[model samples]
Every structure is written in structure tokens, then in C-alpha cells.
Target: MSTDTSTAAAAGTQPGGGTAVQGHPGRLKPRASRPRRGPASYATVSAVAVFVLAFLAPFLIILVNAFKTSADYRSHGTLSLPSSWNWGILQDVWQRVDFTQKLLNSVETSLGVVVIAVVLALFNGYALGIGRIRWRTAFLVFFLGVNVLPQEGLVYPVYYLFKELGLYDSKLGYTLLVGVTYSAFGTYLLSSVYASFPRELIEAASLDGAGRWTILWRVILPMSWPTLSVMCIFFFVWSWNEFLYPLVLLISNENQTVPLGLAGMQGQYTSDPTAMSAAALLGVIPMVVFFLLFQRSLTRGLTAGAVK
Candidate 1:
């Protein structure tokens, strides 16, 4: 009995206070301690916090001031909270600017651009990346150059070109112009993505009697949908926020977009800051709501292509 007790004590007294498992010679090792965070980690966290605060500051200011009256804005200053929550200002601004029509116009233009641009980009990407067209590098470089060309420089030419085509000052003209311009970058982006697509899959599809179009529609598009979705979101948002082109091209108030509508609120001599803030807030709401709705898709699409 004493010998058995001594044997058990010896087995339990292993290195690092580990205990021997019953029916097994191996001992259970102690858990490792977590590493302490150094100053660098804290500094990184602090920098991220600062950036978040900076990004949120303007929106917070806008929110607070949107609820303030002109008198309250002047008295309490920009950062202070409003004495009363003036919900009527939003409605007032909406009615004053004919925002409902502007909202519809913006939505129409943005969606049109997304459809035209995504289709254009997909075709371009397939031809360049899969077709392996001659002068592909040169074509890509040209697209890059076009994307970098300032809109300011092209404004006059575009205006003249559209004027000649009898499309100037029309929503269709604006949509087509922006869509083509945006498609340059999209083409460049998607071509690179398509280049990395699996040749094995393409060959497999072909062996199964799939033509190029069939493969593109059935195989390539299915795999590439995530990237395409991301591009759609980007195109929509960018087109929605377009100001310079819309300002130059859209002459009729009936065809003007949200950004244009927002700009029209500012008077030459006596602009109401509070009302401007309210207008700004209204302009931002649609985009915010859009992002929220597509937030999951955006996140998934962004990471989908990263792995393969």
C-alpha cells in the first residue's frame, strides 16, 4: 500500500506542476500565458481612435446643426447642441428644393450608370483578360491614362461632343457620359481580376461543349459576381455624388441631380447655414441607407477575390 502511494505521488510530481494522466505516461502541460501588449499596440489603438473621431466629427456637427434654427446656430455656435429638435427643417428643405424629383433623377442616373458601366467593364475584362487581345498592355495603359485625365480638361470637349450628338442637357446623355468615363477604371480593375481566373475551369467548361459566351455567362460571371457587385456599388455611389459633370451638363432644373439640388440651396448673398446643413444631411441619408442595405454584400465581395 505504501509503495503504491509513493508511486502515485512520484507520477503526479512531474515538471511544471503537471499531472500524469491515468493510464497514460504523458503529463498535461501548463497553459501558456498570454503575451503582454507593448506600447506600440496601445499607440496603434490610439491612432485608430483618433482617425475614427476625425471622420465622425463633421457628421456629428452636421447632425447637431441640422436640428438647430438659424438663431440657435448663430447663438450656440456650430458644435453646440440645439435647444429644440427642429424636425420641420428637413421637410422645409425638401419642399423648397423640389428634392423628390431630384432624388428620382439622381437614382435614375446612378442606376443607369451602374448598369451601363458594369456591362461595359465585364465585356472589356473578358476580351482583354481571357481573349488575350493584341496590345492588351497598351489598351490597359490607355485606360489608366483616361482615368487620370482631369474632368476639368474634358468638360469642354464632352460638352461639345454631346451638343453635336443632341444629347446635351439630357438625363440619358449624362448617364451615358458618366458611365463611359467610369467604365475606364472599372475595365482596368476587372481585367486584372479576370487575368487571375482559373484556366482549369475555363478548359473544363470548354471540354463540356461550352462556347465562349456560355463559359463567360455560366462560369466566369458566376465566379466573378462578388467583384461585380462591389463594382456596382462603387459606380452607383460615385455617380450619385457626381457634381462637376452634372453641373456642366444638366442645364434643366427638371433633370438636375441631388448634388446639384444641394448646391442650389446656397444663396449668393444670404445663405442659411442651418438650412444648408439640413440639406447636406438630407443628401447624405440616401447614400447611408444604401450602404447599410448592401453592407454585407460589400464586405463579402471585398474578401471573396482575396483568397483565389
Candidate 2:
């Protein structure tokens, strides 16, 4: 019995009948097992999965049906695979809507709004944030108030004002209106951003005999470019998708944008779902391309701001 107990001690077994690992010289305790995930973890994962599916369902439906033929769509419904890819429907919609002109119009309008709005936001942010002018809070509040005002409330007044100025139904008029209106929100946003900027740098620039405009152009603008670029992306997409203002202000077919072009596809009594989906797909392609091209910029800007 003593010989057997001595053998067990050499093998890293405790005299109390507990087992010990024997890899090391001294007896080592056994490693504790990892904890298993509980029901709450599974519940969280399931909720996220459900949200993702819900969000993607419409886009998936649109994509699947976009290539389907009219007969295929009616026969199998939106969820089924296409019998044959009806690629010609896209071309048909394009020609029917004169989509080339619509695309150009959208590009022009969105870019125009971006340019005007960004410039305005820069100036407003500088004055409100850096300048530290009197009643700055009041001005910021007023700009915020402008954002809260509904577009519906201002439509008639804007229409009348444009009509009086002989700018009604003109692309220039619509661009200007949207630009100015959007700049209010831009100003509000940029002012808060600019307020957080380093005052030491501004003071140093001023000590070096730089005027406000010079300092703004050289220092603030360069440093804040990422934020501005992200804002430009947002403004471009927003303006591109705008339907109501364009419909009300731009009466001419030539001035109509991509969204208007898509809506024009709807018929009084009948509609082509396949062609409609094709047009939507076409409309979505540009924004997707735009986002892909600028995705790195967006990521960098967001991360930089977060770190700051």
C-alpha cells in the first residue's frame, strides 16, 4: 500500500485523491473550463439577424425581380428566381424616360447644391464658431429652427416667390432654392464642429498676421476637409433622391431628375413592375458607385472624428 501511494505521488496525483496535471515539475492545478454562452447571447444574435433580414428584404426583392420578365414576375411572384434575365427592360426604360438627360440633370443639381451649401456652411461656421460674434447662440438657434420647418409649409410661398421672380419651373431656380434651404442644416452642423476646433491654432495664425479669410482658407478648411467631404456625400445623395421639390419646382421634362424620371414610369391604370424595378436598379447604381468610390474617405473621416 505504501509503495502504491508513493507511485501515485510521483505521477502528480494528490494524496487526497485529487488529480493534478504533470507537465511541470511541481503539480499544476487543472485548467478551468470556459463558460458557455447563455440564452441572452443567442437572443441578441437572433434579434440582429432578424433586423438584418428585414432591412435587406426589400432590396433583395428588387434585385431578384429586376432581371425577371413580366410573365415570370406574374407567374412566380417577386421571391422566385427569374426564368430568363430580361436585360432589355433596362434599355427600354432608359430610352422611354430619356434617362441620359435625367442623369445629367441630377448630377448637375446635386453638385450645384453641394457647392453652394458647403461654401455657405464654411462661412457660417467660421462666423458663428470662430468669430464668436454677438448673439451667436441666437443665430445658431434660428438656423436650427429653419431645419424644423416643414417643406410643405413653405412650398406655396416659395412657388409664389419664384413665380414673381420669373424663376418658376427653371432648373437654376430649383437648384438655388434647395441649396439655400439645405445650407441651413449644413451651417448648424458645421458650427458645432467648428466650435470644437483648437483656438490656439487660430490665435497663432492671427499672430502671424493672417487675416480671418486667409486663416480660414489655409488652416480650418484643410483640417476640416474630411468632415466637409462626408457632408458633400450626404448632400449629393439627398439631392439626388429628392422628388417633391423637383416635381413642384421643375415642371419641364428636361429639368426633371432621376427620381422624377422613375416616378414618371407609373401609369394611370396599368404599371410595368419589371421595368419599374429596372429603373430603380438603374437609379440605385449611381449612388452605389459613388459610395464605393468614397467609402475609404467616409471611413477615415468617421474614425478620425471618433479619435478626436
Candidate 3:
């Protein structure tokens, strides 16, 4: 009996241990400790704060200076507050810029572009995304051509075409031109988002007797709200801030976009620096509002597949 007991002890004992320690069969093993916040986290936060302040400083300067008169602005340092909040300067700029008209023109043009571009891109992206047509490769190649081709090269040709078609000063002409120009690149971008969609979802929809258009509108468009929001903001910003196209296409003051209208602030004899700053602030506010409004959607789109 003693020899049997000794043999059992020897079998149970680990080589490094004096005696075998039994664990509770039902109890889970303790996991390793997690890492605590350390130097790297603090360093990253501090760097981000510094970068944020640096970028905000210029915007602060613009905001403060927009309220000053040209004389007050020149007399006082840029960083200093004005003696008084000069409401007069804002009024002067509002009138001089014809800012209300310019704002309306910008909104109209942006919406028009958005409506047209999104429609065309949805069709293109849908065809390439799920249809799996033989022309998918050809379509991508064609869009690549449009995106890579410098708009500068097409300027003269488009200008002549518009002139011949009597679309030179028409808003419809500009709207169509900008819309078509955006479609190819927009389709290319949205296609990636579409590709990231689940093949299973598409198959399920089809099995339920959902047509292509039904699946696109019901399943795909709803799921792709983030990408669509981002695209809307992107297109709106580009169209609002576009200077070259307006400079070339819009000959009349009545048809000018905001950027071109703001550029008109630089006069032959005298420049109203305060008005210029104010006008610029006005121009930028829409874009800032747009970004802030759709920021969450953009963030969701960007981080969608990051976690698998």
C-alpha cells in the first residue's frame, strides 16, 4: 500500500514542484493583466491638442477681424480686439458683396450639382457593383479616364461646345457641366462602398423576388447613407469653392458663384480688407456647417470595415 501511494504521488507531481497542487475543475484560470495608460497615450493627446490649436488660430483671427472696420483693422494689430464691434462693416460688406444673391446662387448650384451627380453615380455604381456585367471593367476604365484627364485640357473644348450650343451664360448649362464632370469620379468612389456590402444580403434579396432596382433602392441605398452623405458634402464643398470654372463660364455678375463674387472684392483703386474677410467668412460658413452636420456619417463611413 505505501509503495502504491508513493508511485501515485510521483506521477501527479510536476518536475519543478515539491507537491502537485490541484485546481478546482469548475474555476476558470486568471487572465494576464491589461496594460495601463502610459506615456504613449499622453503624448498622443498632447500632440492632437497642439495641432487643433494651431489650425484654429487662423480661423479665430478671421472671425475677430471680420467685425473690424478697414481702418480699425489696419490701425490695431490683427490679434487685438476692435475698439467696438463694428456692425457697420458687416452691413457694408453684405451690400458690397451682394452677398444674399451670391448665397442663393451658391445654394442653387450646389443642390443642382448634388441632385444630378448622385443620380448618375447611383446608376453607374449599381450597375458595376451588383450587375456584374461584362462592361464593368470597361466602365471603370472609362471613369478612370475622366478622373485622370485634367479639366484644363477639356476647358477650351467645353467652352467652344457651350458657345456653339448657346449655353454660355445659362445656369442649366453650368449645372449640367459640373454634374457630368463629377459623375465618373463619384461612381468610382461609391463603387468601393458598394463592393464592401455583403454578397449574402444581395442574394437573399434576389431570392425573395426583389428586382435589381428594388434591391438597389431598398437595401443598398439605405445601407450606404454614410457614403452618400460624405459624397454630398464633398461635392457641395467643391462646387461652392470652385473659382476657375465660374471665372471661365460665368461672364455676368448675376451668374457668378460665391468664390468669384468674393474675388471681385479686390478693386482697382482701393481694397476693403474688412469686407473681404467678412465675405470670406460668409463663404466658408456653409461648408463648415455642412461638415459639422454630416461629420458623424463621414466618420461611420470611414470606420465601417475597420473592425471586421
Top TM-score hit = 1
lDDT (Cα, tens digit) per residue for candidate 3, span 172-209: 88889998888888899877667667899999999999
**C-alpha RMSD values across all candidates:** 3.5, 5.9, 7.7
Q: Candidate 2, after superposition: displacement of residue 61 in Å?
A: 0.8
Candidate 1 residue pairs that clash: none
- Among these predictions, the greatest lDDT belongs to 1
Stretches of candidate 3 above 4 Å error? 1-37
Order of models, best lDDT first: 1, 2, 3
**Residue 112 alpha-carbon offset, candidate 3, angstroms:** 0.9
TM-scores, in order shown? 0.92, 0.86, 0.83
Lowest-scoring 10 consecutive residues by lDDT in candidate 3?
23-32
30-97 per-residue lDDT for model 1 (tens digits): 65689999999999999999999999999999999998999898898998999999999999999999
Q: How displaced is residue 185 in candidate 1, in Å?
A: 0.9
Local distance difference test, each candidate: 0.92, 0.90, 0.82
Which regions of candidate 2 are displaced past 4 Å?
Answer: 1-41
